[model samples]
Target: MATVADGHHPFAFTFGILGNLVSTMVYLAPVPTFYRIYRKKSTEGFHSVPYLVAMFSSMLWLYYATLKKNAMLLITINSFGSFAEMIYIVIFVVYAPKDARKLTVKLFGIMNVGLFTSIIVVSHFLVSRAYRVPVLGWINVAISTSVFAAPLSIVAQVIRTRSVEFMPFRLSFFLTLSAVMWFAYGLFLKDICVAIPNVLGFVLGLLQMLLYAMYRNRKQVIIEDHEKKLPAATPDHVKNLVIIATLAASEVHPVEAQPNNRNDDGDVNNNAAITEANEHEQTDDHRHVENASVEIQPNETPSAV
Candidate 1:
């Protein structure tokens, strides 16, 4: 019986270890994306909010782990998480444009510096050490729950655009798997605070995967009826008028003719007048042809014809 109990303990420990391993993998999944940003020298429209929230959650978990006994797993995983998130943020700030960099800085200050400091100060002075772990654990749970909700915007964008280009299936799949592993670990440890948020995370992850599968192959259909509804090309007469105007512009200037003898200037002016008259005649001919083309047939109604 002693041997069996020891065997069960090892199995339970293995489960927790596996869960932590998977969770760490998920947390580091964005590393490649950030690396790309670093190489390209652009954030490429990837928002800093997710990384900021992840860092904030890691900070909270680190505090919770410090307050709790036998929380080596939490400390180890969240420490790595904090490091990874900081690297991501650093790359984002370096590559991001001025406006995005400013926003990211403001978010870091508010969440990491301002809010985290406030939480630590308040929790320390107001709450007793005996109750600190539970209090901070619940706080971590709340933060994780909110982070799980962050994918909703991406989901909505996928549905709205009918494009999964912004929504990465690998991220969704790993996140879902991570949530399941963590939930199992939490359940085995009888930690409701960890288990509960992971349940929400699993559901949201599943929803994102479902959305991706549904829309992945679907093409966006854009009808150009508005463009088609625009008035047809200008009539032939109008085209002839434009052509005549262009020809008139290309003709030698009357001032150029004046530099010649007076007789030559008069002849040139008369020739230009004659050319203008011929252009007007051609325009009238085009107009007549256009009007004749518009004539209604005697035997056919206008719409039917």
Candidate 2:
């Protein structure tokens, strides 16, 4: 917990504080996502890789700060990050599906508990004190850079779905800003290890923002093959129910729909269709059961009295 004097390293101190504030937001950005997971009592398909890797990155930086002199700022922020990320990972494990929860726990043990302890033991005993800083610095750089990998899943989702709903623009912007602040702090402190990985961070953040811009307004299409599996007593009802069944199943096969005519009428119609589809999907389970009931309803036939 050593610190530099007030006059010395003023720029580093100021930017370090800024970096801490920005990085704190970055760490907390996932809170709402996890909160939803908690409320729903399920992790859905959301991956735990990001939070786990983030905690490991924080641990590496915290360890490096301890070895390097006058790095109290690094120590303070990374400590919080480590705590926050661990809480997130734990929450995820608690709420995730049984198979997913087991996998996450296994990964956490292998990386955070096993690998981290191994690194500390080897560094303390095998490496000399003078060489420890540089050795750990390189390790920290590698770990820090891997923090960007957390966003890759979002990036992949954006590409696959052709929608930026998973990647918020504000998060990308702040991440870029945080990278700038940290890079400046590192440069002022003359710690290339601290600065270098942030260069990659900044670049990745910009890339995310760019992807957001590119795909933000793209049209999403949901295709459903409504080949009726259930027998309908009424022929007219069956025809009408076919279209509704397709709309209900649209949630499963979403795709990016490119506009063809690019005319006002076409635009209006497309918007209306998209809106109806979204609303239809909001009550998908109910609509599905309703459709099944419609298909199985018995028809009355007039009998001789």
> Which candidate leads the pack in TM-score?
2
Candidate 1: segments with Cα more than 4 A from true spot:
1-12, 220-305
- Clashes per candidate, residues 3 or more apart or on different chains: 0, 0
Which portions of model 2 miss their true places by more than 4 Å? 1-7, 149-162, 221-305
lDDT of 1 by residue, 124-207 (tens): 999998887788888888878877776666666566656664466776787788788778766766778878998998998899
- Top candidate when judged by lDDT against the true structure: 2
Tens-place lDDT digits, model 2, residues 1-305:
23462114789889998999998988888787778888989766566766777788889889988888878889999999999989988898899888989999999999999999999999999999999999999998887776655566556656665666545688789989999999998998889999998998888889889988888876343111112222222444433333222221101111222323455687899999999998888789788989977776488544579
Candidate 2: residue 150 Cα off by (Å): 5.8
Global fold similarity of model 1 (TM-score): 0.67
In angstroms, the error of model 2 at 188 is: 0.2
For model 2, state the Cα shift of residue 271 in Å: 26
